[model samples]
Target: MEPGNQTHVSDFLLMEVTDDPELKPLLFSLFLSMYMVTILGNLLIILAVSSDPHLHTPMYFFLCNLSLADICLSTTTVPKMLVNIQAQNQHISYTGCIAQVCFVLVFIGFESCLLAVMAYDRYVAICHPLRYTVIMTPWLCVLLILVLLLLSTGDALLHGLVLSQLSFCRDREIPHFFCELDQVIKLACSDTFIYTILIFFVVGLYGVVPLCGVIFSYTQIVSSVLRIPTVGGRYKAFSTCGSHLSVVSLFYGTGFGVYISSAVTDSSRKTAVASMMYIVVPQMMNPFIYSLRNRDMKGAFRKLISRITSL
Candidate 1:
């Protein structure tokens, strides 16, 4: 059947995280709490960066963008899942599902690129302290962000457009809470060779290439740090990167876990569970990781809170 003829399709059924009726409320509360925390934490990070003149550097600028991306990424999936759980109806409109896929791709791609950019920022700050201010100008930072946004949006729209062309089986059951790209692709009744090729190209370009850039940036950072003669200088240099390193590890680790789980196991439920680590946990944890590890972020948060309370 041609995809054009399938315009009558109204919705797709999203599988719940569990079949046990008793666990629904618990799952709902858990996810709700996590979602709230993710939002609040990331928001505070943004507010702190904006409010504090001390955080007006390239690192915090990138951090602010990362926080925004985390909020967006979490918002893209969690609320819809929460809505489904609350309504006890796992049905998502066809349009909503496609929109979710597009936003997820955009935010995910943007976040990946932002992390790589952050690593480069750190590399410059540490390896070329004398040139840091001159090199990372405000215009360059803004341009990098604009370029990343454009690329991510373009990639996501391309995928969404291709997805709209594929016919789906009558059994439009997506085996995950959200309309995961791979699961949605599995539902297509038409040939998905082109889609598969596109996925590989995107993963290679957005995923592998950024990861390599991060690795390269950190390599230079490490080499420069090692050459520092004093232990205190080394600690200070490494400290600057600790928060970003932790985030990168969590992001990639959980992301890799999702891929491995999906590959090794036939259980869709397990795959969904693994995805929570990637999609939910990191956003929730990022604020804590930055604030706790970095003195500057901690001070910024305190100052922001003091101002808020004074009002």
Candidate 2:
């Protein structure tokens, strides 16, 4: 639509996963369940790590932050979706969409950076075991986390600012469940070339760089693991990293799948499903992957549960 022909829109209609009236109840129930599980599972991870002295290492400290970010990530989109579904109103206000964009960016960036930091922690633990403690000092951990938070906040605000400059039409309908940055930009009446450039830059910087760091860290970790002589020792070494590797794979795999699906197909419904797999599934799965696979997390969670029950 031309800029002069566009009517200023205060709200946008979110695309529904299905137009079938019969599916609304099913969709609502399914999403609500997923959201609740994501919250509860990640919250338990935070509590387990915080309350257990044994889990007070740099790794679990990052895990706690990751859990918190997962909660935030799930929260940024799910509740609004649930509300819209229940109310049968797909409208999200202009200000609300902007807020959604900001929070999602912040939380996703947090997850991405935290994963990279976790990978680095694994690298130090495995590759330079003798100097691991000295290398990943508590101060350094805090500093890294602070830097991530600052960077994510700045990036989110910058995206939001750029997004606010776009002119949207009256029948503003987002092709996804939430006000995703890209989808919102696609609806703009004005030029989005600059916005596209910003996205590419952000993806390269925030997404690709951290992901490459993870791959590099794991490469070192694998080499170090391979050098261990005994099978038992090698198993033990790999076991330590198993949970983290799983979470990282799930996070990036689903994320990449979403991007690929979006790019390959014109089906918004399929893209929305892929987005859910990216955002909701990983958050819901992280706690389970860690708690079930890692002995430390399991022990901590059991103690946490037992303590709660006793109280």
Give the number of the best model, judged by lDDT: 1
What are the runs in model 1 whose C-alpha is more than 4 Å off? 1-8
Candidate 2 TM-score versus the reference: 0.96
Error of 2 at 211 (Å): 1.0
Residue pairs in steric clash, candidate 1? none
User: What is the number of residue pairs that collide in model 2?
Assistant: 0
**Cα lDDT tens digits for candidate 1, 1-311:** 23333434689999987778799899999999999999999999999999999889989999999999999999999999998888889999999999999999999999999999999999999999999989999999999999999999999999999988888877788988898999999888789997799899999999999999999999999999999999999999999999999999999899999999999999978998898668999989999999999999999998999999999
TM-score of each: 0.97, 0.96
Question: Whole-model lDDT, candidate 2?
Answer: 0.90
Q: Which tens-of-lDDT digit does each residue in 7-60 have in candidate 2?
A: 467788898767788999998999999999999999999999989998999999
Ten contiguous residues minimizing lDDT sum, candidate 2: 1-10
Candidate 1 Cα deviation (angstroms), residue 21 = 2.1
Q: Which stretches of candidate 2 lie over 4 Å from their true place?
A: 1-4
C-alpha positional error of residue 302 in candidate 2 after TM-score superposition, expressed in Å:
1.3
Clashing pairs in 2: none
